[model samples]
Target: MNRRHLLTITAAALAAPRLCFAQDAWPSRPVTLLVPFAAGGSNDVVARFMAPVLEQKFGQSFIIDNRPGGGGSLGMGMVVRARPDAQTLLVSSASNHVFHPLVSGDVGYDVREVLVGVSMLTDVPTVLAANPGIGVNTVPELIAKIRATRGGFAFGSSGAGTSNHLAGELFRMRMDLDMTHVPYRGGGPALTDLVAGTIPIAFMNLPTVAPAAEDGRLKIIGVCTGERVSVRPNLPTVMEQGVPDFAVRSWTGLFAPRGTPQAIVDRLGTAVREALAAPPLVARLTALAAEPIVMTPAQTDAFVRQEYERWGPVVRSANISANG
Candidate 1:
């Protein structure tokens, strides 16, 4: 009575995993790429740009979900809790995933531990700008003014633990200044404050602040790249402005929840390489002035690690906190 039943149950148990794997079929359903910022933002733009191509490649709907809040912590937390299936991914940037976690005391997830990097999308160099009323024209003059004030000035960032925050903190440490960091919800708000005299200075992505600088609302003190950006050759870099070896570039990348199948990660990485290589996508990125970057999963992981190491000390030393 029991022998046949036992054999059947055992066979079924042995076949269960394969059945589940078959069911997975990688995006048997629509895939969601969570953009942890407002729509039309850089991360969102990248996600939207790639969505259709990914859908075409996989023959499934590729949806973009914009969950912007907590300076990117909110959407990140959602991704952290999502199933390890390949369907849910985070289209993220350094602001929240890398720098935010360093400064934020309790973000509920470590980016490196809970998410696996798929590929880096783009790289944007930082720019240090100031309100025209600050009366500073160069990095040296800015430093001198801060010193004269006994480090009394204040600067603003897109938000706590964002690239802007870390860049500002790095500049403060490198220059031995004592300016306070004011965190806003996004770069737009920070730039608004800078132009309105609510804050005297900011370190922001070049694209976000360049227009204001050109219009004379804000003055470009220096770029944070190792060399002058080709598009802005007239603007000197911080390295040439007496701060040696100081460079910061913000980037966006694709990541899946930890425990996702390596095969899925590799597949996604290949798709990313294909997307970036497309001439139309490349032209769009070029038009937006974003430098497209490609990285394998291993390379992306190592790059994220390097970023954490680079910014961790600055965040800790500055005591940057999302709550504070």
Candidate 2:
């Protein structure tokens, strides 16, 4: 070969590895963290809280994009279609994975098929509480009160097809109660109505109503988890209150579009695991009544599959639709 051609070939060979390295070095640009809910909601709160920690770890900006619509399907759909480059992620709760698909007509993507779970951030227990004026101190008492009122009872939920709403539906079916389901725009409004006695009872996230329940403005009849949360060990579980097979847990996690590079997934997952363990982050989540979770990517995937299997039948049997 001519000297000029040989020199050019040598330069090209040397630059190839640098280009490959740049391509493989994930997060070459700012990461877009999608929260599939309105701002100021639980999902948004968790995403905004974790963004700074993750940005610090990766040395890249983690911009939170709130895409709220269709009961969290809009933003989640965006993640599903995003390139599997680890730059786009969905920070959402169990509702998006388990309930939204089950109820919404077409969520545009199947989480099981399109997304890979990285790790769960927290599990927020659902609480069944009533206005103090309702005078029910336990699940059984609440059941009895409902019976005495002859189907006059009404319960509020954050919105239709939400974790809180399904929890209330499960309670109603398990106990065979005849009560009206009142859907509110959000949990805060529902809780306000409950505290004002406008709504007799509500199945809500513990964080939203814990203050009122603690101060005796709202009477917490039972926790809707299989086991009582550590933060409220004194409270009895609904299962223990004579209701069989009643459990509902609200959780948030990080997920990337399916087929993301394993190396990227591993690196991001480790950062998340580290962030969850940070003392300041842990303390902040604790103050919000959120329990941090630890799980490998495989484990996170399995957990979501199990939840889908468990809750799918409940939603199907109830014939729950997003419209109602």
Candidate 3:
């Protein structure tokens, strides 16, 4: 071969391995899981539990960064603008991925278009809980009590446009009850108020309010799932209790910015699925009233899209917004 051609071939051969290494070295540094809600919420709980497992699997530290504001849109926006290197991922849920975009018109970008789903982590059932002082133990009684009171009553939730808030709105619409939604900064505060009797009723995540219900501080009037959840199979569903066609579950998942390498995404999804399948993680999630849902990356994406479509009409019909 000519010297010039030999030199060019030598250079090309040396450069190929470097490119392969760069592509394979993903998560070469610590990964950041950005949770849009406060630390104590369900999304945070899922992220925190999965971080250690991911760290071990990837051989790098997985850090959770809680950025709470704008009803989770704030943290979502941060992820939308981040590099699609899998170094930073958004720990997303129904609140931001499905409901917020439908309610908040100025989100700047479509969530499904900007974020790619990695895996679905868990599905948490929403519960209709009432303070013990409400003198109601079932959905029928709660509806009767609300009807008897001439003035409308308020029901609290984690925040405006959250899954629980949407569940409350759906119940109000379905039952034709006069109820105003009270949005707290987070589920922890709303739950605290429910236990303290500051709010008579709340539609909250089962995990958040299960402890109080067990202690007799509050009563779970009904589970909001269409069918009973495995964690609390004895609890009746709102639909079974007389509210027709009602189901709302707050789910958590992992999402990378659009354009993230498919390899990195697949690796992450595999790790998450394995973690969810393990006995220890399953036990922990079950105790928290959260069910581990193992979905492939494609399935996760399809599920998010389905949720967005499912809740769009609900938001529009109820006129839900972030400001309220």
lDDT of each: 0.83, 0.83, 0.88
Off by over 4 Å in 3: 1-16
TM agreement with the true structure for every prediction: 0.81, 0.83, 0.91
What candidate 1 gets wrong by more than 4 Å, as runs, is 1-29, 59-61, 132-136, 144-151, 195-197, 210-218, 317-324
The best candidate by TM-score is 3
Model 3, span 101-125: residue lDDT tens = 7888768988878899899999989
For 262-306, candidate 1 gives per-residue lDDT tens digits of: 888898899899899889998877555577898999899999999
Error of 1 at 147 (Å): 5.4
Residue-wise lDDT of candidate 2 within 96-195, one digit each (tens)?
A: 6678788775676668888998988888888898998977788889999898896467999766778888888888889989878897655667788899
Candidate scoring better on TM-score of 2 and 3: 3
The 10 consecutive residues of candidate 2 with the worst lDDT sum are 36-45
Q: Provide the lDDT at 202 for model 1.
A: 88
Judged by whole-model lDDT over C-alpha atoms, candidate 1 comes out at: 0.83
Candidate with more favorable, higher TM-score: 1 or 3: 3
Which stretches of model 2 miss by more than 4 angstroms?
1-30, 196-198, 215-217
